[model samples]
Target: MIFSYFSRRRADRFAQLLDAPDKAEVESNASAYHHDAHDPELEKLLHLGRQLRQQMPVIGDQVRPDPDFRARLRQQLMDTAAARGIGVTATQEAEPDDAPQTTSVRRPGLRLGLAFAALAALLGLTGVSAASGDALPGEALYGVKRQTERAQLALAGSDVNRGQLHLEFARTRLAEAVAIADNPRLLPDVLDDMDEDSTAGVFLLTTAAVDRGEPSLLDAVDAFTSQQLPEVADLADTLEGEFRQRALTSLDLLNRIQDRSAELRRLLPCTSSDSAEVDDLGPLPQRCSALPATDEEESSSSENRDSGSQRGNDTPDTPDASPGQEVTPTPSDTSMPPSDGLPATPTPPSILPSPSTVPPSSDADSDDDSGFLEDLLRIIGDLLGR
Candidate 1:
């Protein structure tokens, strides 16, 4: 019971660390804050905080305030009061008021000018941010999106928060990729960057997950894949061949990351009988029910190519011929079939008849051939009768 109480207190302490004050007193001896004894949950939280801290962007060495700043302010105040007709010696009082007048007038003007400049710069920065916030992945202002996240990470102090932030921005990148993916000129580059963002986000999430001993970030990835990725996949599926493959390739990369995490596999909703655990190099992770075709599609396509049964290759049978009737020959091109994949085997000259060998016959020629056949049959019949 006593150990449980201390663990609760430590949990409360760690909770406070989540909202740690800017000037909060941290232990000079870090060991004082770290205790080896804890339940699995508490252990996970500690590991999460540690990973988040490590993931946060390192802002360069912070410049501390000058030790004598207060003294400098005091001296400046004393000199200012002495100039404004307070505690002045008789010798100083007779001095021209023009010096102080100039100081007073110029100081206010200088301050006003600086204030205006600062306000203008702030407005400009805000405008840029607003414009960039709505920019898609391939657009020029997309760089602003990334730089903004870098600033966020620089400011974030919690590792858990930082990892989450990375995934959030990663989703934003994906949002952009999906939004502008229909534009052929823009899609390839945006998708490429989207892949990088997803890979990085997954990597960070995995690190945090391992440290925390749970796939906590899986929910976020699932949300992104469910909501945003479908559009990208749909757009890619509309394409005919290689471009479609490129889109699927990126999609698969993301799935591979998900495949490695066991918790993620259990959460996935994809279920294809063909996608069942096979001899996958990716270790045969469970799949979602709605995921697009994977290596299975590629293999199926290869089979289609090899068998030459691809679309537009059907051949019609030749029409039935009457006795002694010659049918008109169709064009060789029409007679033969369309082909794909490997070339059709060639018939050797020795075994094949020349095109001229098949003589063409008109309707008149067929009538003459039939009459001769009738006469020959009649003569044979008469000989048998005698």
Candidate 2:
């Protein structure tokens, strides 16, 4: 019971030390309390309390929250309480009204600044893209122009569309070449780019036309070459030396593209998807030796052959006449009667007869004559057929 009394007294003295306003008062009270109690536990507790009191102000300065954060935190507490179906009256009472108003006023300014920055950046890129459209090879924005074209090609829906884009870019490159014609360093490079784009575009367009069996698709290549050829020739005329040679080479390529397009159009009808021969372009057209016969031509030839056979069957076979008797010509026989004592030979039908008619020596000779006439008629029909 006596120890319990001392313990309660010690607690009361420690509580008083906590309330002390200055470090000197805390030190003075703690020394007096330690001397009266001679209690080691209470002395240790008092020393820790004194150290914490001394450090509290430093800790507060370092860990202080921003005014904006405090305002947001209070507002968040109110919002969270409202979300949970709890009364927000207590939270509202704890926070000042002006804090939320200040935050609301500041947020719009920050957002507006961010929006302006983003818009400025977008406009800057757009300006660069626009300026690059007219830029030449060594200009700063030229790479940007090429990159934009590549982006367009990436977004293209089909090879034909991409091919057309490549041709258009090639034209742009040609314009650049003309602009920099005085700059020997850049002229060759620009012309090279132009040639590359032209070749790529022609290959793509021709391949598409061959694959789809649509000769009309080659019209794009023709149009591009026709429009560019004169310009290229004029440029070649203006240039000299190696540059002139380069321009001439580009001109030749354009001519070749035009010829190739025309050839592909002529041959597209003969090509098929399963064609065996293919090049960098699509399938090569099969070389046709002869056009196929139409159904009407075949039917007419069949009818002619049948008629010739029927006529041969209708011709009557005559019995051998005596060598001493005079022979009479039949009504079907258009030839005059033979003057000599010999039998009249039957004439064959003459749809397409040989120039010289010979009397058949035997039945095999007659059959051979009929076969030769039928073959002649069929050849004529095929020649005249569609």
Candidate 3:
């Protein structure tokens, strides 16, 4: 029993040698081979027939299978002794061999154990290969999945700012995939998903910035438009129209104001008396005539017309009331130079006569006269009243 135990332990140690570098692989093989050497544990009842053949005394006889009558007779005598008590007693009584005989018994055992260890190592390698194929690249999976989720969120709603942020993330991932993806077929889905929002966001932001005079954003405009998002195009078109009109309007106002410094100064009450130059000397009627119709006012009028149309009504097509007819001060009033350069005595109200002239011809004529004079008088009064 002791010799059998030592032999089994030696077998296990030799098996471990096949997997010297890795503990996990060796442990797995040890667990699978947990039973005894030929364990399908044999029935405890000994097969005396087989035992007798294995222990038969055949020393110096080459121990080859018996082919002669003498050998068969010798083997039968040993079996008969084992079956009857004498051979059994002798086998049990044999002195234990501690060296040469024990070593000889282990030779075949060592070879068998080495064979099993090799088989276990091969199985271990095959399992490792199988496991590695399913192992995911964690960083790549995290980054790509995050990007895909963001793209889905952006496409679902109308949140412009959030959508833009997500679109940028998706775009970065798509660019990475483009550079490294082994398969071209994988590219189109990611690209198409990314384009769904990235194109629109870039278009809107670029056009808005361009209108604000940030020329840098213009770089993205063509690509944005090329993607052909209808909503993007519509937004760009609308903003472009408003910006174009604003620029033109500003230019128009600039021109109008440029040529009308005298009029502006005249309308402003805070002008100093001595600021007037030689060119500033003029009659009030003549100064009023020089106040040309400003393009800003024309734009304002057009805007009014547009608003009125939206109300589904024709705005009265009445022409702008003409500037009031300025009546020069009588020679009597003009001859006297007042303390200020202003005309002497109150000029009759612009819309009202001295109550001495002939009345206007008809209500139509009267309405016209009143509109013109009333407007001019009101403007003049507002200026002086400032």
Candidate 4:
């Protein structure tokens, strides 16, 4: 939210305060801003600012600027200003050694020039960063892109935010790899960087999820892996040999993250992770036992058991035999033997009609069948005697 113009003005104001001729001027300027000169925080900041300003000369001495480069830069600025129809006055030559020196007046033009130079530098950096956003491996601006990512990670407000930034950078690396797919030499390294980012991101996010007992945080991990897995798999499909293996390794990492997220989701319902085991991914969630049956559930189960037992007791023990119908007797060992002393041939049992299909029989019919069986036995004995 801090605009460049506001930042520049603040920096200019601080610089003016730091460059004050004496402490009185600094106090006068501080009073203009309604800041007490004796305030502890203001004193600390001012002290630090003064210390930093004091070091500038030593820094300048250690790293001297190239005159030719400076002249070229100045000429380039003049040329640019001319192109934009702005007048840029040239610097005057130094005065004679014997000439008398007078009190120096602050040059508004010089201040304006410095401001323009700072603005130009800022714009140039902005343009480079914007261009670097899409830079691939071996490109001039790729290093800038990575540095920017590192800065973002360093400035992240929380572990979750840092994890997200890692994943975002990982996606950027993936795109870079895809852009440079033809460069086999660089592709593996890019993929390797992507994997490292993915690991760090997953670890941070998973650790946060576990420590906070918030499985919802894992949604980001799931989303990232789901989207990247297919793309990496496809890339692996198109590659061969070592490169393909490298891509497959990244794919494997994605798959592991996915499985880890799913497992965390399942475990998040557990009340505690105090006894959980730790691994490279973080703590493995402890096995959650089935919850104890609630009162309603226990009551429902008991009612069911009672109903089942009651139903069993209510069932009839024996069905009523229909009147005038003889019940078939089961065969017993007391049956008569063959008269000829030969082994009796066993008759195959016939299929019986169901009770519903049988017609009611009279008692006289049953008595006649019984007598007929005895008559058959007597005729067999008579044949044997003959």
Task: State TM-scores per candidate.
Answer: 0.35, 0.43, 0.19, 0.44
Q: Model 4: which ten-residue window has the lowest total lDDT?
A: 347-356
Q: In model 2, what lDDT does residue 125 have?
A: 35
Candidate 3 lDDT score at position 350:
29
CA error at residue 225 for candidate 1, angstroms: 3.0
Query: On residues 171-246, what C-alpha lDDT tens digit does candidate 1 reach at each position?
Result: 6766665676556666677667666555555544443343333445556656655654576577677654666777
The residue-by-residue lDDT of candidate 2 on 130-179, one tens digit each, is: 56778788887776676666545543556678678878988998888888
What TM-score does candidate 3 reach? 0.19
Q: What is the C-alpha lDDT profile of model 3 across 1-386, one tens digit per residue?
A: 45688677655555453434565664565466567433322212123333444566554354343235467667766765665446336555344635343213133555344433332322222333223322322333333334233323322322234324434543453444334344333434444444433433433332223223233333343333333333323322333344334323322322322222222222222111222111111111122111123324345444434432332122211122123432233332333223334323322222221111112212233345344333334333432344
Single out the weakest 10-residue window by summed lDDT for candidate 1: 310-319
lDDT of 4 at 79: 64
Query: Model 2 segments beyond 4 Å from truth?
Result: 1-125, 280-285, 289-386
List the candidate 1 regions with Cα displacement exceeding 4 Å. Answer: 1-125, 137-140, 263-386
* lDDT (C-alpha, whole model) for all candidates: 0.45, 0.58, 0.34, 0.57
> Judged by TM-score relative to the true structure, which candidate is superior, 1 or 2?
2
Runs off by more than 4 Å, candidate 3: 1-36, 40-196, 207-212, 227-386
Task: Kindly give the stretch of ten consecutive residues in candidate 2 with the minimal lDDT sum.
Answer: 349-358
Better of 3 and 4 by lDDT: 4
